[model samples]
Target: MTDPKISAFYVAVQEVNSLIQNGGTSSSRSLEEKIVEHLENAQLLGKLPKMGGAQEEVFMEVTKHGLRISAARSRLVKLRIPLIELVLLTTFVDGFGKTHAVFVEKSTTTRYQLHLLQLADDMAANVLCSLVKNAFVEAEEASALIEVIEPPSPSIA
Candidate 1:
């Protein structure tokens, strides 16, 4: 049986990719706004896990080595992991605007890999590939946009 968490992650990725692919031309909302709305809706619908509280933050960074996914629970502490530890099994983009990526943990030999879905236009796909490649170049670290935000305020009000 497929893991529910993985399924939800795939769904969220697919929706985000679709929005990026279409460039929000057909929707009244801008792409940035639509992304935030979609994320909230996904969490509400149980397609993505909800944050435990206002202090929790999750982010992904493409570094000179590999993708780093980090979860910060408190203001000063975070856990970061490398995405390359997962083996990419397969990837495909269909004519129907669907893209699928499968990955398995490096320690696992199972045929099944975590599945990720996305939508992308030709331009977006090219750009994504280029960016990923650049992320692996050691020199790119100087130019990469990292650590975008400061710690959130303890309270909004």
Candidate 2:
């Protein structure tokens, strides 16, 4: 199944690329405006769904990593992605666009590289795999006959 978040991320990336191509001079204002417009239109800043238990912790960790943008400048620029949603968003639904995951090594005083990954298959399988791994193992084969039990009439009391 095609994930909607992935499509939205692609659209956002295309918008930014088009803006950059047409922005003439490489001005920070122009690029920033373009990002604001696209993010607002996509409505990704809205509320994210609740994920309980261990999944929530994983979601938090992924979010912390997802929006780790590094920029050297004089102006204040802030980008935010809800932590939990990003895991799912970037998984099957969201694309990296111009931005991507990276590892920074302070020793070099530079970004190592931008790494990209697709989430579709991994996200879907993780859920099922976790369930299977956690399920109890039974020692004997258990079979039960199908039976319909109707409630007795209330007046019987």
RMSD of each: 18.9, 19.1
TM-score of each: 0.33, 0.20
- What's the lDDT for residue 75 in model 1? 30
Best by lDDT: 1
Question: Which runs in model 1 stand beyond 4 Å of their true positions?
Answer: 1-9, 12-61, 68-83, 89-91, 101-104, 107-112, 139-157
lDDT of each: 0.39, 0.28
- Per-residue CA lDDT of candidate 2, range 1-157, in tens? 2111221011112212344345576665644454445444444554312112121111111121232222223222223333222212222223323321111111222312111222234544354223222321111111112234455777855
Clashes of each: 0, 3
Per-residue error for 135 in candidate 2, Å, reads 46
User: Whole-model lDDT, candidate 2?
Assistant: 0.28
What local lDDT does model 1 show for residue 18? 47
- The sequence of per-residue lDDT tens digits that candidate 1 reaches over residues 1-157 is 1111111012322323344456547678764455445544665677753333232333334454454334433333132224455333334443334443323333333222232333233443344345455644544454354555466779867
Residue pair clashes in candidate 1: none
